[model samples]
Target: MKLTISDLAKMTGLAKSTISGVLNNKDGFSEKTRQKVLQAAEQYGYVPNEIARGLSTKYTKTIGLVIKDIANPFYSKLTKGVQEVAGEYGYTVFLCSSFEDHHTEKEQIQAMLSRRVDGLIVAPLLEEVTFDHLFDLKAKSVPFVLLGSVPGLDSSYVEFDDYDGGRQVTEHLLERGHRSIGFAAGLPTSRASRERLRACRDVLSAHGLALRPEFTFEGAQELADGVEIGRKLIAMKERPSALICFDDVVALGVVKAFQSEGLRIPEEMSLTGFDDIDLMIFPLTTVSIPTYEAGKALARTLFGRIFGGPDTPPQRIVFDEKLVVRSSVRTAAN
Candidate 1:
């Protein structure tokens, strides 16, 4: 026994079209008529069907958000930021995890698009060079903002200053008199990873030193990967005096592995990490990226594109990363 707009119209003694206009908040309706319709609807406990309303207004009042990994604390903070802003605008967010897979990312994007979300915030797989799926989104005129670097794709995005962060950490290690350094890289296809590795190399080159190929390890995204890398480093006949990890998670795993092997941090080896996630109990030196602020910025930018008309210029915001020095790294013997 659900009440419909026609029932509301009959109850209010108004035309069905009048009832619809008033309920939808469309202009050209008198205040008295609007109030009457509202009162009637409230008396009947009528709830507007969102799907039906969307069909007429063309807005679902929902947005899609896709991130690399939901399990990552960085994205968790970022998602919180996005949800906070979305709540203020009376919009719901549909979150999806890409799991760092290109095919999965594309499928999730299509699913979100099929649901007719008002806009999207994506952290696309930067490992793959092709972005046909993103191009398709643009061709379909769907508003979206990227959360990370996607080289050659001229789109609205918010990214971290990974290069500078790399330099900061590398220079700090160098200033501590540690010339023999190692880099634990993330995905090789990631532009952020490449930029960070490049910065490390550049800084090392400036100091008349070079990162040894044998010491550089790639594909260290998870804790297990870091543990494996740590075991490999321990087995090495000649290990670097210090290591720079891709993220805090990996660094934590490495620290655990090193400690289990009776190696003391800073005294035996120094370590640094990026994306200073709160999960780490170890006082590891790392770069802190403002992931929550970046999320808020992404939502704000996406809304701007959604409501600011098609002519709204694309914006690219880059947040600088800060190096948080801690006891994990100490001055090396000259």
Candidate 2:
């Protein structure tokens, strides 16, 4: 049995409109009357219907967060940051994962819209350029902030300086006298991977060296991919002295594959990774991005659009990536 506003009004000897106004926190109700209605509602255990209220006010007090993969530690940290800020604003978050599938991403966005979420924070899939679902959201005037870059989207986004991060890694390797270097790329369509690869090439070009075409490995999205790449490198007649992986997970996989064959890290071959994930077993030389802080920024940017008017100019927040040197990379002998 549920207590309605009418029941609350009868219990407190007040008009139904008075009870409704007080419960909804609308203006014009006297403090005494407000307290009276609240006391009766509390005593009677009256719970307001959120769906009904949302219809009247057009504010659901909820938001949706869609990420690439929830199992990834980077997104996990990012989610915590978004939740912390959303909590402070009295908003509930509906989380969804695309699992790096474009069709699934479209379905998730449609589901969020059907639920009437106030806003959305999405980490768009960089694989395959079509974003008709996201464009539809724009046409519908829904507020959304992207977590990563999507070329020609013309939307608000939060991203790390992947190009600069790649430059740093390549420069560091060059400084360590590592001229023969290889790059293990992520999904071929990934913008981050492309930017990093561009940086590596640019830096190497400036040093009168070039990334060998055969040295570049692509389509590394999982640990198994890294293991396969590792085996390929081992069988090569001449392999690069160092390898820069797309991310920490792939780097870890490569490390595992190498160790299984008695290959010592930074001794026989050096390796580095991006998005320095917290892994105790491997002290990888990688680029560290402030993933948690980036998540908070994504939510904050979305809320700004939600409350600060839709006319607010789109914001592009870019966080810097730091290169953390560890035992995985070493100076090459001249």
Candidate 3:
């Protein structure tokens, strides 16, 4: 016989609301209460019927994980972190990729909502800045966490210091006596790109350096795009002696691009990247953000909000960026 919430409550000798609170991890229940409820459920080998639970409580112990592009390594790391915690909590995750398409993002969100996911984790498509769908979610009281910065939304988020990262990379090149530095920025689909570019510009201006219009380029976070941008920059008449790529994927591409053109690393041109992707065994100089840590922190914060009640004063968690110095970057020779 399938056990119901009522049966579980009866067995635990707790009120229905108390059991519900325990299941949803709502506050006001002591840890002892929670443990008793859990122990009773386990002892009875009780399995929650998702459909019945949804109908009775209007909650689906599932979360929607929407990202702009999963092909990027950074997002992949975030996914790993989220999955690790979600597994421990015995919750399921529904993965959705927007591909930076707003229409598609909207459609996917609707689908997830229709399925009645309890919460959402999103890396919104910046171009499709419509929050009507999100507002509807809020109206339904579904918790949502934004990955990176989202304008016009006051909610939970997890992001690193992109501006400082850009400034540090640019400054590193400047200090190395490389006045001409190239920048390979990602698609303008995210605030991360904008902040990084702004920092680069600000640092350059502070050093009385001119940011050549030709030295900047934007592309998708694809290796091919990175390679193409690298080639274009290196082949210019007055190419930069140093390059600050958007991420390590782009830096790897720059390395390939320079190699194809027979340019030596740190000899003719120096290269640096961000996000210290795991497979980069060649020790590329770059900024490392513990993406896994970011993901875990984001999950913890989100779970806290869901159970501990809405946070006042807007919780903002910022992490420090580390500079990984490797052989890829070097001081320019006179």
TM per prediction: 0.94, 0.94, 0.83
lDDT of 3 at 85: 78
In model 3, the clashing pairs are none
RMSD of each: 1.8, 1.8, 5.2
The list of candidate 3 runs beyond 4 A from truth reads 1-48, 128-132, 310-313
Q: Write the per-residue lDDT of candidate 2 for residues 1-334, one digit (tens) a residue.
A: 7778888888889999999988878999899999999888888789998887888888999999998778878889999999999999999999999887888988999999999999999988776658788777787889999887666778889999999999999999999989999999988656678889999999999999999989999989878888988888888989899999988878888998898988889998999999988763688889998999998999999999999877989899999999999888888995
CA lDDT, candidate 3, residue 66:
89
Q: Write the per-residue lDDT of candidate 3 for residues 302-331, one digit (tens) a residue.
A: 666666654433456777778889988888
TM-score of 1: 0.94
At residue 232, what lDDT does model 3 achieve? 86
Candidate 1, residue 39: lDDT: 88
- Stretches > 4 Å off in candidate 2: none
